[model samples]
Target: MSESEQLMVVDSTGQPLYPATRKKIHQEGLWHETFHCFVINHEEGHVILQQRAKQKKDFPGLIDITAAGHLLAGETPRDGIRELEEEIGLVRQFEQLFPLGVFLEELILGDLKDRERVHLFLTDESMPLERYVLQTEEVSRLIALPFSEFARLTDETAETFQTADQEIIHRDQFVPHPSAYFRRVNEGIQAYRVQQT
Candidate 1:
């Protein structure tokens, strides 16, 4: 995504204020909108995670949600469904997405200040690893982690995960979202699994 791309800015209540360039919004600490989707496979008891491409402008090489992106100026939460297909090559209908909740998050690091109203969604879908045609500029690879193990790592209830490539030591590999945010995401996954059963 271009830093010059236009985005819808909003207030604390999520009421749209006006349009602003992505760069300006981040620079000014203006609240903007983002979409976060977590892909879960309850039957297999796993969740998908994507490794961001090293060339990404922000958070490069970090392991993040299954798919996520900023909502353009005229986009709604439903419109954000395209991100799943664009980022990870998962074409999904808007109805397949289950709304978790909207969360306001702020992060500041040196000159970068990000404030976003995150539209979170959960989807229970499983596909073969080869099915994902990753956009090399945005994503490097994808992995599946046991849902129970993910929850434990997020809560610091467990520390290490052995994957085919290498051993993952939670904090050393994953993106640094606040512990509560991870807890909320884990709970959302659990709740969705319960509803399915």
Candidate 2:
């Protein structure tokens, strides 16, 4: 399995554990931390979304937010920004992102147990899709959808969004708009709007 396929365990405060014991540690709930990126195209008023590869251990073939990963031990949320570069070749400083706050999310999907204290952030400007170098086994395809349309679809009943090649799925089962994940994003968007005024 690739880095994306590997499981990472962190303490409740988001500290990474030794690689060998991570799987079992995660089960024990010693630590937990996840980073979610909502990359938006402010100029276009759209958000970049990725279609996870069918081979993913969880939520395979689902459309998800722009980028996400676990914050390794001893790493700050800003360090996660660096992980994004490792996963997708994005290189930027912390100032470019707007901290959207954090939320605790717990879910049981199939046999896997997920308990994450997720850190959310938003960037209205992101590197172009064409410039992205995807970790293919992890990501099958990418799409730039209007933010307003995403809000609309969340209200609709579509299953998920599939990529042009059909190798990746971009629908709700993988990532839902009304979900806690989206709720935080909405909060960030609202906060951003407030700051603008």
Candidate 3:
């Protein structure tokens, strides 16, 4: 199988085990490592989110992280920077990203055991939404919302997010990631926002 069709299965602690087809991993709920990056626009008090292409096999049309993907066999988390370029047409140095620590996210999407040891990261990029050259095959568009507005979704205080452009995004539109993952992501961006200021 191709890189997109296969994943590097890892133990719960994120140590590599072996290569497995993405199907098997999902079927078995096996632990796998994934790289997730969140783009922070501190100047605008916004966090960028990607709208997954409707063609996506999983979570079609859902709002997701800025850039993210599975770590194929023989790949390390650092190499995940490629996802940014491939998905959003943004070139970045690995060092430009701030580590938010590894997190475990578990979800059952109709028998798809989406268990991931997420290598989470945050990067401050104050670019305009129009600057992103989205790969329409993976991402339909980019949305930027203020940090507090996005936080309300995870904290379950709000049902929707209004983008900087004034577009309305319902909470259910986001991928059903575990609450802990969203919490950590929020905290990471908040701290980085302060530093950038």
User: By summed lDDT, which 10 consecutive residues of candidate 1 come out lowest?
Assistant: 162-171
Question: How many steric clashes between backbone atoms does each model show?
Answer: 0, 9, 0
RMSD to true structure for each model, in Å: 1.7, 4.4, 1.5
TM-score, per-candidate, Cα-based: 0.93, 0.76, 0.95
Top candidate when judged by lDDT against the true structure: 3
lDDT of 1 by residue, 1-197 (tens): 89999999999778999999999999999999999999887777888889999998888898888999999998999989988999988999999898889988888877889998999999988676668889999999988877766787566555577543454646668777777777878889888988988
Which pairs clash inside model 2?
Answer: 10-31, 11-31, 12-31, 15-73, 16-73, 63-170, 160-171, 161-170, 161-171
Residue pairs of candidate 3 with colliding backbone atoms:
none
Off by over 4 Å in 3: 1-4
Q: Between candidates 1 and 3, which one is better according to lDDT?
A: 3
Per-residue lDDT of model 2, residues 35-54, tens digit only? 78877766666677777888
Q: What lDDT does each candidate get?
A: 0.85, 0.67, 0.88
